[model samples]
Structures are given as structure tokens and as C-alpha cells.
Target: MKISIITVCYNSATTIEKTILSVASQTYVNIEYIIVDGNSKDNTLEILKKHENKISKWISEPDKGLYDAMNKGVAMATGDLIGILNSDDTFHSNTVIEDIVNFHKKNDIEASVGNIVQHRENGKIVRLYSSKYWTPEKLTIGFMPPHPSIFFKAALFNKFGNYDLGFKIGADYELITRFFLRNKIVWEYSGITTTAMLVGGLSSSGTSSYKLITKEIQKALAMNGIAFSSFKIKMRFFWKIIGFLKK
Candidate 1:
């Protein structure tokens, strides 16, 4: 099966090369690498050109934001499977894609996800979150798989829909809820680690993290058509704080 991996970037010259090398060095041959740049003013485009031969398709132009650029990449992708790799993240190993394909072949699953290692800016490993087994109830309590480690069949997007551009911070969470949680897609958990992600991502930033989590809870409730009391939401936040404290 052909797998399409997309990297959406903007002014990411510092880490773009590593991301490109990670994908290019994959053992899986039936892969398409696409990069969508939001008109990066830095040398990101130049770096991409240097590895143009390895990349299947790339576009550098002004766009709305991260999700907008991701939409363009998804639209251009022709592979049967799709996954997104942030410009700041890299695969855990060269055979990660090959392992994913082998798992897909063995199991009749519409999507697959693995574990992720979160690393600091100084290249220090922080925490490891495993996306082994997931359910809607787990999601309601604010548990979510790392988006970068998720690989879904391209046809699933057609059945569900693209990322909701309406949400700035929680669109990925919303998509996860809609496709995997609500619709109950057949997803396989490999238990093997997949991606090494940079610690300081958009969702993990300062006050935005709180805002995004609140929005995610609201979106989850609305999408699932569930009524949640304020007390329940507060309890959810309490559980989240407990989870963080334990970590």
C-alpha cells in the first residue's frame, strides 16, 4: 500500500532538514512525501529544494495557517494511506513506516497509532505517551493520541471530512473525535513507538493550552451529542490536573 506523509511548515529552517531526512530515510519504498509551506520567508524553501529529488511534491506559498496548508497537502496526496509529520518531529526509526505497513496488512484496520516521545528543545527526552488502546470514554476524560503518530486510510477522510478550519487550536482534536471517537473507526494500536516530537508545540504553549483544552472538551461534547454538566467539566479538569501531577 502506498503511504502519503505530509509535513506542513512555516519558517522552520532549524528543524526542517531533520524532518525531511527522517522521511527520506524510511525503509518503506511505496511512500510519497509532500511538504506544504505557508510562504516561509526563511531558508526553509531553499533547504527543501536541496532535497527536492527525494520529495515527491512540495509547494511554498501563502496560506491561512497550519490546518490550511495541511488541507492542501491532503488534497494533493494520491496515496492510499495518509499521515502528517510536523516539521519539528522525526520518526523514531528508519523502519517505522515499514512496520506500520506490515501491521496494516495483518489487521483490517482503518487507522493505526503508536507511542511518541516528547523531547525538549535541548534534545532531552521528557515524557513518553503511549497510544495503545483508545475509546470515546477515555477521550472524554481528556486523553488523546499524539496526532503525528496517527496513520489513517485516505478513504476515511472522504467518509468523515477534512480538519475543521473553524477551530484554531483544537481542530486536530475535533477531527480525532469525529472520525475515531464518534464514528468508531476500526483503529489498531501497534504499541511500538513511532515519532519523537519536540516539546514546545502549539497546543502545549502557555495560556493557549488551557484555552485549547476547554475548546476540545466543548467540541467533544457537541460532536458526541452528549450533555455535560459544569460539575462534570470541572471534574474533568481535576482529573487532568491529577494526570499531570502523576506524570
Candidate 2:
């Protein structure tokens, strides 16, 4: 299977090399690496050019933001499956892609998910995010599956549609919500830690950003026809606090 992995970044000169090398080093040979740059001002472009041969296709231009660049890459991809790897994240191991492909082909599922661990720049793992046997019924309560650790059958985008550009922070949540709730998309967890994410993202910034994200997630729930008015998303926030202690 030709799996397309996309990395979207703005100014990732310091860490883009690790992301590039991780994807390039995947044991799965039939892989396509695409990088969508947001017209970086730093030496990120230089780094991308240095490893241009490993990349199947790439584009550098100003985009609306992260989700916009992700959508662009999805449109440009010509693979059977698609997955997005953040510029700040890397694979958990060399065989992660190979494992995902084997699981998908064996189980015959449309989508697959894996675990992720959040870490500091010094390589300290802080939190672990895992969806242990998630189902569509559970998603109505506002629980989200691991986005970066998910690989989707590319054809599903044509069936359900792409991420909603209206959402600034919760587009990934919204897209998965639409897929599992309104559509009959089959998905399974691969029981592996596929991604190691660096901490300090938009959601982890501070209280103001967290509140904005909660509001956007609420909007997404509504847009996806999930009647979660009574569901307290604040509980999800508390769940993160619990993860720091438990995981």
C-alpha cells in the first residue's frame, strides 16, 4: 500500500530534520512523504531542500494555518492511505508505518488509530494519550481519538469530505466526529504507540486558549449533529489533568 504521510509546519528549522528523518527511515518502502510549508522565514525551507530526494512531493507557500496546509496536502496526495505527522512530532519507531499497514490490510478496516506520548524538548515523556477500544457511541460525549496517530483510507475523504475550515482549533476533532457519527466509517486501534509529540501546543498554552478550544469543540459537536448539550466538555479538561497524574 502507498501510504502518504504529510508534515505541515511554519518555522520548523530546529526540529524539521528529526521529523523528516523519522518518516524517511520508515521500514515501509511504499511510502510518500509530503511537506506543506507555511512560507517559513527561517531556514526550514533550506532543511527541506536538503532532504528533497526522500520527499515525493512538497510545496512551500503561505497558508491560512495548520488545517489549511493539511487540507492542501490531502488534496495533493495520490496514495491509498493518508496520515498527518506534525512537524514537531516523530514516529515512535522505525516499524510504526509497517505495523499500521499490516494491521489495516489484515483487519480490512477503513481507519486505524494508535497511542501517543507527549514529551518535552529534553525528551521527557509527560503524558500518554490512548483510545482503548473507542466506539462511535462514546464519541457523542466529546471524547476524541488520537489524530496524529490515525491513518485513513484516502477514499473516505471523498465519501465524507475534508476538514471544516471554519474551525481554527478543532478541525481534526470535527472531521473525525463527522466520520464516525454521521457516516459508517470502520476504525480500529492498532495497540501501539505510534507518535511522540512535543508538548506546548495551542491547547496547552494557557487558560484563554483552553476556553477557546472548548468553545470550538462545542461548535463542532453541534455541526456534526451530536446532541451533546448536556455533556460537560469541562470534564474532558479535568481528564487531561488526570492523565498527567495517571499516565
Model 2 alpha-carbon drift over 4 Å, by segment: 239-247
Looking at model 1, the pairs that clash are none
How badly does each model clash, as a count of residue pairs? 0, 0
- State in Å the error of residue 20, model 2: 0.1
lDDT of 1: 0.86
TM-score of 1: 0.93
lDDT of 2 at 147: 89
Report how far off residue 115 is in candidate 1 (Å). Answer: 0.9
> What's the TM-score of every candidate structure?
0.93, 0.94
